[model samples]
Target: MTNTIIEFKNVTKQYDNDSPVLDHVSFEIERGKFYTLLGPSGCGKTTILRLIAGFTEASVGDIYFDGKKMNDVPANKRQVNTVFQDYALFPHLNVFENVAFGLRIKKLKESVIKQKVQEALTFVNLAGYENREIREMSGGQRQRVAIARAIVNEPEVILLDEPLSALDLKLRTEMQYELRELQRRLGITFIFVTHDQEEALAMSDEIFVLNRGKIQQSGTPIDIYDEPINRFVADFIGESNIVEGRMIEDYLVEFVGGRFECVDQGLNPNEAVEIVIRPEDLEITTKERGKLKVKVDSQLFRGVHYEISCYDEDQNEWLVHSTKKANVGDEIGLYFDPEAIHVMRFGESEADFDRRLEAYDHGDAHEQ
Candidate 1:
């Protein structure tokens, strides 16, 4: 059986005088995988990291690392490391000293520390920059140094707190790939916290979506994207057109725009559902060839494709991705395959939605 390296069981935390910041969050992170705590700002992603790092104590319940409870263990005592958002390098120290700082504290032999520090630097592709001053290195380089610093200590787990949030877009994207590759090479469990949906989707083996101090959903990137549990997740993760509808049967769904046949099951008849269709899932056609006619309200160029906003007879706004041209006032057809329709359960709260989605996956596997 695989080991669950990190476990949060009914964990809750709150400020001394404020409302709770984390409310009974529970999840298991497997060893040697990349897990992301993804959500909007102040949604408790960072709070979970703090709880794991022992920066903050749990208000209730328990946290565990490799079957060992982490109640009173100080941050430094835990076999864990953190790479903060700001890199947090010592301005007065060079790259070599900063990366070697952790090892020196452990009082390791100079030769072993030197070899490990060099290996960590090379793992981050900063092999020859050991002498570079922290003030002289670029943002990406400094970020890597921070990572090298953490990994050089050979911690069982590394917790990254929005470590790429400060870099330029291009650099951040590059570092995302590098960090993923490094994690795989080292075979260390990485628990990353970030608010960027694309970053989480691109890097995480599994993602935990949080909102308002609760876990909304947890799954692989494809699982979360193709089968979001609620309207909030459907809207937050990517560009999606949320169409309100009613399910008539296991294979049929009806909306104000039109009725379509789908392949999804386990839904009740005549129950209201929210249909989530990604913008890219939609195809544009002339009014004569489409299932539904919509008047284009605006079009914005997004480099490779045009993002067109439109409206149907019910005055409900819908967005379509198209390479074809349709002026602001022109009417066109929006076509989508039935497979693109994802139904959100009616009257499902965030936590309820998460549980239902997990159960659905479990049942699907059992049936298979």
Candidate 2:
């Protein structure tokens, strides 16, 4: 059976005399999935997390948990726990006491609190460190402690607000794997907030990309990365070579003073559009054997591949990642298959974008 753990309906949050921090945001989170609210700072990622955790009430609209309205639910009454960026463990308390804090507040039996705390600590792989003070733990260890404390309460959902942002790169990467594994083993919903695209793409079952208090897109990582809805999404998710173009027909597009075949449809004839081609999708070859000819402006060795920058006759810059080496000022040809091209409309909402994609897919299926 499908289970939706959280739902937001036209949620808007505002402060006095200020613009709304979250503007009519609406989405749903299914049970036992890892979801990432991804965006830059002040993009409402944290705001959504706060709303879910009941840290703050939405200024307008309904919030629901498990088919129940939660607009007036207090943080303590909600079936969710939060792990903050700072860890938030009591400095004076040992790991055991910290993990047992919530259980103790409920006046649970000491035996019950002890068992729950031990289980939570073991789940986080901190089994033997229960007696250690919070100050004695490393950053990653303390993070695990915070997670342990939250899990001990046995909440149905865990909200993490940039919890790994304070760790060093190596530790952060390690914890990312550990956290994902923990969530899988626990079989509870996890809602993580972050501005780091790599973190979101690497860990999330689904990602909601936000900007300016609005969600630009929400899909699996591969979907958002490979088929961004607009220039903002394309640029923010990863490196993309975007250029203005016109849709000549269902399968034809025009750009860089040349007409090319693409694999997109459902656009008005001669409609202005933008084309996105990832750097890794382009292949470098001899001018006569290539689809687009350009002069190489520069190249950078990026370990896996060389990032080559080239400009066409129309002075449109194209970035390509290729294993082949090319010198500056060298005239080279770039080749790409029709399927590598992604066409995007300007200011298209996610709903409209999905409809267009559905139509395109339907058309393809009918032809077959």
Evaluated with lDDT, which candidate comes out highest? Answer: 2
Q: Which stretches of candidate 2 lie over 4 Å from their true place?
A: 347-368
Candidate 1: where are CA atoms >4 Å away?
Answer: 349-368
Model 2 earns a TM-score of 0.93
Q: How far is 243's C-alpha from truth in model 2 (Å)?
A: 0.3
TM per prediction: 0.95, 0.93
lDDT of 2 by residue, 143-198 (tens): 99999999999899999999999999999999999999999999999999999999
Q: For model 1, what is the error of residue 326's alpha carbon versus the real structure, in angstroms, after optimal superposition?
A: 1.5
Over the stretch 275-357, how does candidate 1's per-residue lDDT look in tens digits?
88898988888888877788999999998999999998889888888787789998888788888888876676656655665
**In candidate 2, what residue range of length 10 has the lowest lDDT sum?**
359-368
Best candidate, TM-score: 1
Instruction: Compute the lDDT of residue 306 as modeled in candidate 2.
Output: 96
